[model samples]
Target: MLLPQPRESIQDNQKGKVFFVALFTVCFFIMHYGIFVFVQTSMFFAVSSIYRGDLFNLSIPALK
Candidate 1:
């Protein structure tokens, strides 16, 4: 059976590490931006809904 050389194994390990690091970095940014946008949109919708409700209440006259 053929055996792996020490230098070649080291190089392979380095390549694997680099690939994983790059992948992690990309996924981290994507998740971060996704969460940020989701939160922003949710807040905007919540605020707008509350504002609309207040406007509706204000426009309606109170019954004596």
Candidate 2:
């Protein structure tokens, strides 16, 4: 504890913490999206078959 404290209000402290948390969250999600795309596009580690999963599969034929 110092004898003379620099000026800082509670709101200022809260705002700083909030800003840091938001920045961290944004970075985290960006990294998450990048890794997700890499895995889905570049890897076959997924055991559940893409066809069996009943979602999107480019191999299936499309009707005109």
Candidate 3:
């Protein structure tokens, strides 16, 4: 029936969105961790702040 086709298409769209979201989330976390590990804390915080819209960049290099 036409009703079933629409329902299936809707489900497919939802699944596609969910998959992309999860993939992006995983990539985001991985990239963040990699940056923190490879770069200085101050630089990392500044970049992270930009992405997070934080009030200010907390550059604490000594913490490293």
User: Model 1, 1-64: lDDT tens per residue?
Assistant: 5674465556765888867988999999999999999888767856665343443353323432
Give the distance in Å from residue 7's predicted Cα in candidate 2 to where it truly belongs.
20
On TM-score, the stronger of 2 and 3 is 2
Instruction: Report the number of the highest-TM-score candidate.
Output: 1
lDDT of 3 at 18: 66
Computed on alpha carbons, the lDDT of every model, listed in order, comes to 0.68, 0.62, 0.65
lDDT tens digits, residues 15-45, model 3?
8876798899999999999887756755666
Worst 10 residues of 2 by lDDT: 45-54
For each candidate in turn, the TM-score is 0.56, 0.49, 0.43
Give candidate 2 misplaced runs (Cα > 4 Å).
1-10, 44-64
| Candidates in order: C-alpha RMSD to true structure | 10.7, 8.3, 11.2
Q: Show model 1 residue runs off by greater than 4 Å.
A: 1-10, 50-64
Q: What digit string (tens of lDDT, one per residue) describes model 2 on residues 1-64?
A: 6463344644665778767988999999999999998788544524443333333544433331
Q: Please identify which of the two predictions, 1 or 3, would achieve the higher TM-score against the true structure.
A: 1
Model 2 residue 38 CA deviation (Å) reads 0.4
Judge candidate 2 against the unseen true structure and give its global Cα lDDT, from 0 to 1. Answer: 0.62
